[model samples]
Target: NNFSKSQSNFMDTMLVFSSGTDIRNLRQISAEIESKKGALVENQYRLRKSEVELRRKMRDFNNMKDDAESDPFDVEIMEIEIQEAINSRNGARTYIEAALKTILCMKQQYDAILKNKGIEDVTEIDFENEEEEFHIKKSTQQAFEDIVASGRISVGNNRYLLQIGIMPNLVHDYWIKFLGSPNSYEKKKFDEAREALYQQLKGSAIKEANTRGLDELFYENSCVRIEHRK
Candidate 1:
């Protein structure tokens, strides 16, 4: 009987121990499940965020595609307009250059005529004696006055006139002196200086032409060859 009673007490103690172990295992399983649920929720949130960003990018790309399709000729039209502007600029430049060349030729002819008439200095010429022959016409003077009053003598359309107007009288005096120089040494010095200036201008023009990728043959054909008088 005592052995039977002892065995029953030992069995009761073992059952309580087993019950405590089962409770601890259950708590651990519940904690693990809660942790897994939290991780799944976070992953789902990240996935939704990525999906939203992808949709936004796709929408932007579609909008850009629609815009491009709506105006397929936009780029071509811009190119044509740019080409037209370049052509217009080139035409204006050519016109201005021609006008300047004409003016320079006229001035050279006038200087030659004066030199032939034994006029060394235009400023020293007796204007009173030749007033009837070379006086400015009233109509011409009035037109000049009107143009000045209208402020039309600008660098754009009247660039040649502006250049002539801005040049000092001393320039003409110096040219006259150089031309009437008695010594061959002075004439040679002036010729050398003029040649140097021409070379500098030619170099600048060549540099500009090269930068624009102009055809060498076309540039050479367009250039006026200078003939230096011996």
Candidate 2:
């Protein structure tokens, strides 16, 4: 019964990824998308079950009218529980919505790439062009990485920032990334440039007791990590 309810809800809210343009990859992409959407619904179902249980306890307590009015402490605790449950349910819904949007964006990008390659009706010439471009891009990225490692180029003074964004509380994965490249700092000017890029951001920015604790600063910023290749 719960599974049926979740399926119904999932189908209603699913961000459609199909465009009917490319028949070759549609089946595979559609299956994967459906699986991803199903997992989200399953997560929501579990969260809502806990919420319903909390609400039931509140209801049962209220049914005992005399006891409910007499005990103020327990009643207050139940009220807090109900509020938290409401928050949890709402958080799950928000998470599902965001995930769907992200999924849709990724699918569009995938379709665009596929169309650019002209793989809808692939030919020998198309395969040759793809192979040539792949090697060129790969070699270019490798060469760029090598140049950055040489330390001959004066990279400038800059601070390395780690930004993290948490959503759906503990249920979803926390997004973490470097705000900018640590290599942007000049190697000659900054003595710590070589090691700072790897070592400086290892510990927590927030001071407590443990200087080793890194997770403490994760929720400080509501930011998503974006990569920019120069």
TM-score of each: 0.27, 0.41
Model 2: runs farther than 4 Å from truth? 1-39, 64-70, 121-136, 148-230
Q: Rate the local accuracy (lDDT) of all candidates.
A: 0.39, 0.44
- State the weakest 10-residue window (summed lDDT) of model 2: 170-179
Q: Candidate 1 lDDT, tens digit per residue, 77-183?
A: 54455555555544444444443443344344445545666655332123322322121121122223334456232233233322222222332333344445654
Q: Report the lDDT of model 1 for residue 99.
A: 39
Model 1 residue 12 lDDT? 27
Q: Model 2, range 29-121, lDDT digits (tens) per residue?
A: 556667767877886886788678767976866864457355777777777877787777776766676657645754665576578866554
